[model samples]
Target: MKGIPMRINVLQHTPNEGPGMIQDWSDKNGYEMFIYHPYQFGYLPTADETDMLVILGGPMSPNDDLPWIKQERELIQELLNQDKPIFGVCYGAQQIVKTMGYQVTKSPAKEVGFAPVYRRDVKFLNIPEELNVLHWHEEMFEVPEQAQLLFSSDKVENQGFILNHRVVGLQFHLEPKEDNVREIVVNDFPYIKGSVLNQTSEEILQTKISDDNKQTLYKLLDYIIEK
Candidate 1:
């Protein structure tokens, strides 16, 4: 690991939604962390300087008319061309798929709340056949060509995918810590209506966090950092 700082660039889409569990893991592992908040801050990190890039979930679509979306998509494509380690969640995953010539459309049913994701292929992931993962997305992205399908849910077929074992696309929120979950319940409750998330904020607080899911996330982060 000499000469490599294990630096991670986090692209945050919303002001309230920042690096959650990823920040904790990075801090504990002594990895350098940089954040790009497109909402408040008007800039994004350069792909060449980033060893690992994490694109956090957002409420916007990948095909939105915003200039930043286009810029981020272009950056994703650039990173893919360079074969850099990339991890994208929710809308970020959608952006990755879009950048790779796949389409991201509205899901037949919105997947929100605690849902079970079954492993399609457990090659790199260290998780069980079925695991409970946090969900908060209305759109789902198609798996790009040549990507390995990893996880899926009853509602969405493409819950997770791997590209050349270096890039990952996750439709669910794997970085939701206790505080992040609470914040989402309090601040984004109004948008949860008519979706699979029909529980109250107090109900969400009582939901248990599976150790398997946590371990899977750690394994993923470790894999990316080691690569």
Candidate 2:
């Protein structure tokens, strides 16, 4: 008999900020995708029903006192309690750090476009030691206790981290598609300032993520599954 397909539950905080390349990856990788937009109307899946958990980026901070925020953190905590495989992006990554009892602070400069990062140290995701990836957040989390620091950029000390080699948190936008970028830029361009680390709208739109980064993201997903 054929085995059951793996189920990937995507917890999205915003409607526009949907899973980009992640949705494509799941369709091609034989994983069933279920998205929960608590902001609109939905309930988070039970831990037993979810094979993988993906927390997408949002505009709100993890520290926000919204009801959904608390519920989502509770769900993430439960998932972590079981050592579930998880991939968090931007605000999602910050949520992981905050859930682990750490501070996610506002960086000195907002990273509003492509930025370079040194793949400091990680055993799970095999990526180039150095590469420029997509970015669009201002807050950075301190390295959480018992979590391996995976990557870092000049503007943020904590770009990525891994807990128990299963729960991965990434502050960058490794899975953003063209539409996703356009949407965020259109809706939230006011946040982009003229800081040295900030990129202009034109520059951000012009910078096409190369196939190398796409491949690495896929490999990262595969690593999560195979783990």
lDDT of each: 0.83, 0.82
* Model 2 lDDT on a 0 to 1 scale: 0.82
Per-model TM-score on C-alpha atoms: 0.94, 0.93
- Per-residue lDDT of candidate 2, residues 73-178 (tens digit): 8888888898888899999888888888899888876888888888875644667887788887878887788988888889787888877767788898888777
- For residues 1-227, could you state the per-residue lDDT of candidate 1 as single tens digits? 57766779999987666778888888988889999887566798888788889999988998789888899988888888888888999998899999989999988778778888888966546568888888888899999888889899997898999878788889998788777888887888776778775766677777887767667887777775555
TM-score, predicted candidate 2 vs. hidden true structure: 0.93
The per-candidate count of clashes, in order, stands at: 0, 0
lDDT of 1 at 9: 91
Can you tell me which runs of candidate 1 are displaced by over 4 Å?
Answer: 1-4
Model 2 misplacement above 4 A: 123-125
Q: What CA RMSD would candidate 1 show?
A: 1.7
**Poorest 10 consecutive residues by lDDT, candidate 2:** 118-127
Q: What is the lDDT of residue 103 in candidate 1?
A: 95
